[model samples]
Target: MSCATLFPRLLGDVGGTNARFGWQAAPGQALQNIRVLACADHAGIDLAIEHYLHSEGLDRPRAACLGIACPVTGDSVRMTNHHWAFSVQALQQQLGLQALRVINDFTALALSLPDLPADSKIPVGGPLRGAEQAPVALIGPGTGLGVSGLLPSQGQWLPMAGEGGHVTLAARTALEFETLQVLQHRFGHVSAERVLSGQGLEDLHAALRCVRGDTAPQQPLDAAGITRLALQQGESSCLQTLDMFAVFLGRVAGDLALTLGARGGLFIGGGIVPRLLGWFEHSGFRREFEDKGRYGVYLAEVPVWVIHTEHSPALWGAARALDQLH
Candidate 1:
């Protein structure tokens, strides 16, 4: 079916904290009326969509596609980092849509990568370009961690969605080792997400404080507050937390690149990394990414790009999903 005929498709990129929506009126038409809504503000996906359509004064769409932060096995869908859950078939029926496609959020993100504007992505290290036919890796830390990729398949890009973020974490350095021990004690089997996400940032800060024995009475801080302290006020503890964050992120990103042979590129997404670009480009991210002893030479060749944009490119990915670009 021609995607152009699927006019006025409803596109959504739903995350843990926020859900961004857009309208693709036709195949070549730019996404219209993009809006970001707090997930907490709505009761469910159905309500959220209804609100958006009503607010925009848009008629019911012929088709719809949503990329949510969860697994879409069978018809049932549930978000991992948030409380929203619904059956795909039920939503389609409720909205009276001819088709409703639901997919993993990061998968949609991977789909958007090939069409990303050059200005939207800033390369961090290695060659400006990578192996043309090789796979690409993506890892991002936000309300939670999201990991995915795209591989060349039959002259097409196949996007992958898996829980790579939950893999067991590896650590080096005295502080790193001690912090890992603290995290393991608090939550058995420390996953990479334990130390790489927004909540992970807060938990990591607490763990570092516990490990370093700096029990000084101070105001509690979330990821944003911690970032402010480190970036603006030059707080020592927060600075160390971010440094360790870069080290672990680099290690995990390197591991993903090796696992997938993703020489095409390793792109960093999510809400956290882009915000830390000032400290990130200068931090140990690139160094640790290539810190592998035997694979150092190979990893050094992989490029890394940080995505920076206000609009969710995943919204486009959702539209692509509706188009069956798989």
Candidate 2:
């Protein structure tokens, strides 16, 4: 069966905070009527889809594929950061679709690596060595941290989905070590996600205050407020927090690259990094990325790109996966 036979397939990238939907009219055709719906606005996945279709004046699709922000080990899926939960088979039946494929969002992102347009990404540091055949690492921080990788096997790209963000965060500098100590005292385990996410930014600000022995506000600013103060107003605490966040992100990215031997490249996605591109480009991200003592030269040879595309790669990956089914 050709993808043309599956005209008007539904492609969705369902994240913890928002759900993006698009209509793939045919194979190789551009996605149409793409819209993002807040997950909180809907009661369940079924309602969100229904509202999207109705708003777009689209007909019921024959088949659908959703790249969801959770492990799709079976038919049932419970989002890690959201309240939406449903069974795949039951939802398919409810929507009267012939086929429904659900996959991990990070895995979908890994699958889209080959298709990522050059203009859609901004190179962070290092030369583009063109190690296309080697493995590629994917890590992003949003409502939570997501980690995955793409391995080239035979003539196909295989996506690896794992909880790499939950690994113990390594600290090199005195400030980083102090911050880690503070985090460990408060949260015990102190996973990388604890200091690299939206809430993580807020937590980092509070930790910095504790380290400096400064008085903290009764209620510190949220992630957005902190970002605004740092980028627009030049608040010292917010700026320091963002700087540490970038450095920590780079350290974690380097570890992941070394662990996976991701010489092909490292790609950064998610909602946060792209917003602070200016500061991130000038921060210690590249330095930390190549801070591996003996392996510094090797990491320097590897390229790092931050995805800046308006359309979600996960949505594109879902469409590609649906085409593969045919």
Candidate 3:
């Protein structure tokens, strides 16, 4: 269904890190007034929307859809990684929107997979052709790891709602085994998200430092800092850390691809990955991805892509959801 009817409506993709806002101008029209606002600066969703609307001198939109990082079970939603909480109905009333829709951020992203342009994605590995009919996997490492899929069935792509990121991650090989052992002592269960998320990058560095007998390490580095240090061209430690991250990411992506038989390709979203694309394309990620015992050949043919669009995907997905409802 075309989104023309939702024209001039407000769309938001809210996350723990940033809140992306946009307006759907018309069916097949480019989303406009795209803006990213720091969620930490606002006290709540209403205030955040108010700040954006007031700053732009815009009127309250007729219809609104929010792609929130937290689960939208009922009226209230409490973000898992942020301190924000509010009721959807209340927000609609406060904003005077005729209809308001809210969905999980990852689910929203899954919806927009079929709509992303070729220029917005970068291929990391695998066959690029004939992926249109295969199931697509979507995974991202941000405030938390998100995993979902778009399964094509009977001509329409259906979104799969599952917690694939929470699955157990087994460490193969000596070095990876050592990293696992180091992390096991700190956290009981070592899920993939534990080592592939923002804090996961730091956890990897710390684990490596500990394994290498590096004096317990000092200085707390965020994900970006760790990536910057790795991409500095000559930092051995940072390079090792990034290599570890890339390989692990590939392994995770490969596993997801195999689990879903996602020959349609695996799309990487979230705030990370895009900056480290150059390093990723040259890393051991591809080799590790196709390292699955005998099923390696099957995975070797599946494509992988990185969603690099700055557009508010969740907003678009939310709009899609609204259109589906109508």
Candidate number of the best TM-score? 1
Q: Looking at model 2, which ten-residue stretch has the lowest summed lDDT?
A: 1-10
Which runs of model 1 end up more than 4 angstroms from their true locations?
A: 1-4
* Rank ordering of all candidates by lDDT, starting from the highest: 1, 2, 3
Choose 2 or 3, whichever is better by TM-score: 2
Q: Report the error of model 3 at residue 153, Å.
A: 2.9
Candidate 3, residue 33: Cα displacement in angstroms equals 1.1
In the range 160-275, model 2's lDDT, one tens digit per residue, is: 87878789898887988898899899999999989888988889888888999887455778999999999999988899999999999999999999999999999998889999
With a 3 Å backbone cut-off (N, CA, C), the pairs that clash in candidate 3 are none
The local distance difference test score of each candidate is 0.91, 0.89, 0.83
- Per-prediction CA RMSD (Å): 1.3, 1.6, 2.2
User: Candidate 2: lDDT of 241?
Assistant: 92
Task: List model 3 lDDT by residue over 59-138, tens digit each.
Answer: 77877788888667789888877899998889999998778888888888999988888999899878775366889899
Q: How much is 157 displaced in model 2, in angstroms?
A: 1.3
Predicted structure with the largest lDDT when compared to the true one: 1
